[model samples]
Target: MKLRKINKQVWLTEVELDGYNVRGAVICGDKKVVVLDTLSHPRDMETLSTLIQGRALIIVYTHADWDHIWGTGGLIWEDARIIAHTACLERFNTDVPVTLHEKQLVEPARWNGVQLVPPNETFQDEFCLDLGSLTLRFYHLPGHTQDSIVVFLEQYGILFMGDTVETPFPCLEKQSPLFRWITRLQRWESDPGVKTVIPAHGDMGGRKIIQRNIAYLQDLSAGKDPGVFEPMTQFYRETHGANLGFALNASKSDAFKLDASKKNNP
Candidate 1:
């Protein structure tokens, strides 16, 4: 893992594991050091631990996806507090173990010291913590996953969007409300404080990424294809197809119908 300092207090690291390029972040505040999602393996976090040694550590998982939380066991700090959205605990207990078992079948040696470590602190809608000079605000953003959360660094004007916003297009989770997702993206885009947006998988950008995502979602919601707007690699092409499928399926559901009714009536 190579660490690149984004600013004096913020650092970013990208790790390539098993063909997946995962990015993690570190924020060294006045009172505490925050570790933003851990990478794919216990071994991947070894360098991160060395960098933030001898500080009050707080680990925040963007979501309970296996690639993000697999390094939890590697963190040796006894005082470290793991935080995530409330639904992440359920994913850790159910989805994580199943994923681990399935992956172990293919490559057992890579996951040697990994263990299931669920978040000790969780919230439903939002959670804020003051790190003296900086404040971390976590908001529940459901487009990527039900447990997905984005962290906003109040002092730096940076928003860590997790998988809520990605390059080319955003991925969709089952039952994700199209209107709510687009509304949230628009909210972040319009925020004056949010000067930079960082997604979990891709290159970081400004508010334009959020606007692009909104356009794609809007197009899909209106029964139009968004593929012509942006060029996608083979990987994102498949992802786009899946996202379209999810949006189409979600639009027909009762939840979306009710949301549409409320919007139209209001």
Candidate 2:
């Protein structure tokens, strides 16, 4: 795992967790510690928990995706609190069977031979978790999923976006209200407090990446072809080509590109 301090109390950990490069956040408060997302595999979560040793762990699921929440079972203690957006609970109970089955077939060993577990606590619209000195704000940003939430460490100026805007145009067929997703992306882009965006699948970066995402989504909505994925994919491949084999060979990516072509040529 690679660690970087983004702000005073916020820390980013880039872990080669399972089959994905998962990023988790640690917010150290006056009395305790808060974790943003867990890893993808039980082994990774065990490693993370062991590393955090004495600190109190508060795990918040940014969304209901398997990569983000599958390791929750490993991270939770007897007394730890697990929270997520209200919609996420619904997703966990209803739609996640398909997601889990897909993941199970693709990588059977990681699912732990169990079903998806709904989060214990859920909130709507916005919720503020008072971590003594810092407030971790959870915003229900539903484009990624109806239950998708973005964690904003207000004092730290870091937005832990779970598949919200990693690329110029993130595929949104899985989102509930596509237009609303676009709206939230624009709002985040304009917010100066959102100094650093730590995405679930990419490197932590600045607001300019948000702008690039907006442009790509806009291009998609305007019936303009984005060819095979967005321009950012090419940049990502060139910049981190050696480490980005997943992006280059993603099955859904070609489908996304085909969807763009159909929309543009329609």
Top-lDDT candidate index: 1
lDDT of each: 0.83, 0.67
Which residue pairs show backbone clashes in model 2?
168-213
Model 1 per-residue lDDT tens digits across residues 166-252: 876787877777777777778899998998999888678998989988898899888778865355566777788887888788888
Question: Candidates' TM-scores?
Answer: 0.93, 0.77
- Across 64-136, the per-residue lDDT of candidate 2 in tens digits comes to 8777776666665557777898878788667677878877798787664543556778898898898888888
For candidate 2, the per-residue lDDT at 259 reads 40
Q: Which residue ranges in model 2 land beyond 4 Å of their true spot?
A: 17-20, 113-115, 174-176, 227-266
* Model 1: ten consecutive residues of lowest lDDT: 257-266
Kindly report which residue stretches of model 1 are placed more than 4 angstroms away from their true locations once superposed. Answer: 17-20, 228-231, 261-266
